[model samples]
Target: MGDEKKRKMLQRIEELMSYGEPTPTIEPSLLKYLDEAALRGILETLERRREKLIEDEKEWLAQFRKEES
Candidate 1:
């Protein structure tokens, strides 16, 4: 992917990440320019990052509970 397209993809991924929920279905218009491989790569990367965020948040909450107790 070109730098500009990559940047836009990353930005959209970040927006999805901030939603703090499962990744929503990407609109076809937004993805029309990318091939299957690029689309898969973006989805996989987003899923991995989202999983990490959930794990980190869980750990943080656990620690907070420990401190409170």
Candidate 2:
């Protein structure tokens, strides 16, 4: 893909991330450009990061409650 196309794709990915909970469904045509492995890797990475964020937020909240007490 050309630089312009890559930039546009990255922008779209960022837009998807902004949706927060319940990730938006990617269009089939968009995935058609990516291989299965690449798509899977991207999803797995996103899931892992989301899980980590949830865990971190839980820990922070617990500590916050302790400090309040």
Candidate 1 at residue 36, lDDT? 53
TM per prediction: 0.55, 0.54
Worst 10 residues of 2 by lDDT: 7-16
Task: Give lDDT tens digits, candidate 2, residues 1-69.
Answer: 454654455445544465455555565456447754565567567767777888999988887674543
In lDDT terms, how accurate is model 1? 0.68
Candidate achieving the largest lDDT: 1
Name the lDDT of candidate 2: 0.61
- lDDT per model, in order? 0.68, 0.61
The lowest-lDDT stretch of 10 consecutive residues in candidate 1 is: 20-29
